[model samples]
Target: MFGWLFGRRKQEKFFLEMMKAAAEGEGRRKLFEAASMLGIIIKGAGTDEEKCAQIASGLVNNLLKASGTNINSNEDDQFVAALFSVIACSHFSRILTSQFELSAMLSWVILTAGDIEKIEISNQATEYYIDMTERKAPVLIAAGNSIAKWVNQPTAENFRAVVNVFDHCRSMVGYA
Candidate 1:
């Protein structure tokens, strides 16, 4: 699907330069956008690590051109929620992890708090994240306190807390 996405070889140097620029004010958003783009790009490469890395290299070449990174802008909320679906799907997440420092960047969504978390995602993204963690099950359960953080919504304040809890249990298997 993404045969045209990766045709060159230089990646680390390109990522380094992108990171340097993305560290600045406006550029940080670019990094986040690039992270999301990496997810999209790698998924198209299937389960082959070589192909995923190749497409990822292309991301480095094209990172500077990404736009519409504003998650809170107008209708981007829908995109964010849909991204949650992509991220939660095991097939895609596994493919995405096969390339880059993407796992690190994806934590951008997991570690999100306060402002960025405020973008009404219909709680879809957070719910998906919870499912992702749940799949880790007994292993993650041993992590205990670490996983509890995902259900941070107040028992009363947030309208979706109970709904999220029930939804998570619906597909959870064994001890998860």
Candidate 2:
């Protein structure tokens, strides 16, 4: 799987550049580019699911925390959420479910949902959330618990976002 993806030196270089772009945290443009590449790579990923999952986790973490990132653009945020959906729909979902810190992904969905007025990004985030929750209910519940306080702050829109996130987590975990 690794060999096929990186078989060509050019492909290797592109991967490295994408990683560099993701790491620099200079702007959302490069992070978006890296995310685009991640979608492609994940879609074509073969065996060696472990490696692919690790890559996904790292790429996701970097993208979410990228310095100067505004997460305000519908198009840019959609791409990132779509990447999560891509992995969710693939065999890689298991790795993501079992090993990743999905709270961050969930946070992204919540935060981005609040920032944008469009439905495209929200739809994608919903897809990813449902995908992860189906396979990792316990993890989702625990993660939700940890962040629920922060998300449910009294001053934050009266906790509408927290209610939404908690409602989803509960429904997924059979609590609602």
Candidate 3:
């Protein structure tokens, strides 16, 4: 069962590579197809954190380059935004910390506020970190500090959430 679950991830990675090649060759049609495949992978297999992290890392690297052609274009931005949104809200948030590149990509997602409010995705991301920390302190503390920098500015709602996160972290000090 687990093998079947992870198989889709492998397929997704292969498609992402193909997409990267297509985009590099400036094959717009293939790029679009690759992007669509990525979107499907994100939607379907995103529950696997490592797979989602891998996809996010690839998309961020490729999309940035692709965007250079018309980085500011609404359509291009929407595609990248959608990809980021899926990973940000997926069940694999903790898997993000395992890969430094993916973690950096996640930081970008937070910095850019990519579709965050649209799905309240950023909040979910913070929650994932908090939960991870409850299981292990040091690993998550570093991630928390990095993530905290992104959400440091506290509006009333954000402030409340941050406070709750800190409280959760405090509770798990030696227990974890």
**Candidate topping TM-score:** 2
Ten contiguous residues minimizing lDDT sum, candidate 3: 146-155
Better of 1 and 3 by TM-score: 1
**How well is each residue in 1-176 modelled by candidate 3, as lDDT tens digits?**
56666698897898899987765444323322433443523334442333444444444444344334222344334333333333332322432224443543454453354545333334444454456656775644543442233223323443344334433433343211
- lDDT of candidate 1 over 60-175, digit per residue (tens): 22221232223333333333322332232222224334432343233233323234644345355446556757686542343232212222221222213322332233224222
Instruction: Candidate 1: give the clashing pairs.
Output: none
Which ranges in model 3 have alpha carbons more than 4 Å from their true place?
Answer: 1-61, 66-71, 88-176
Lowest-sum lDDT 10-residue window in model 2? 146-155
lDDT of 2 at 168: 47
In model 3, the clashing pairs are 49-92
RMSD of each: 18.1, 17.4, 17.4
For each candidate, the alpha-carbon lDDT, in order, equals: 0.35, 0.42, 0.41
Off by over 4 Å in 1: 1-69, 78-85, 96-116, 119-122, 126-176
lDDT (Cα, tens digit) per residue for candidate 2, span 62-103: 334432233443355444433443333232333223333343
Q: Relative to the unseen true structure, what is the C-alpha lDDT of residue 9 in candidate 2, on a scale of 0 to 100?
A: 89
TM-score of 2: 0.24
The Cα error of candidate 3 at residue 112, in Å, is: 2.9
TM-score of 3: 0.21
User: What's the lDDT for candidate 3?
Assistant: 0.41
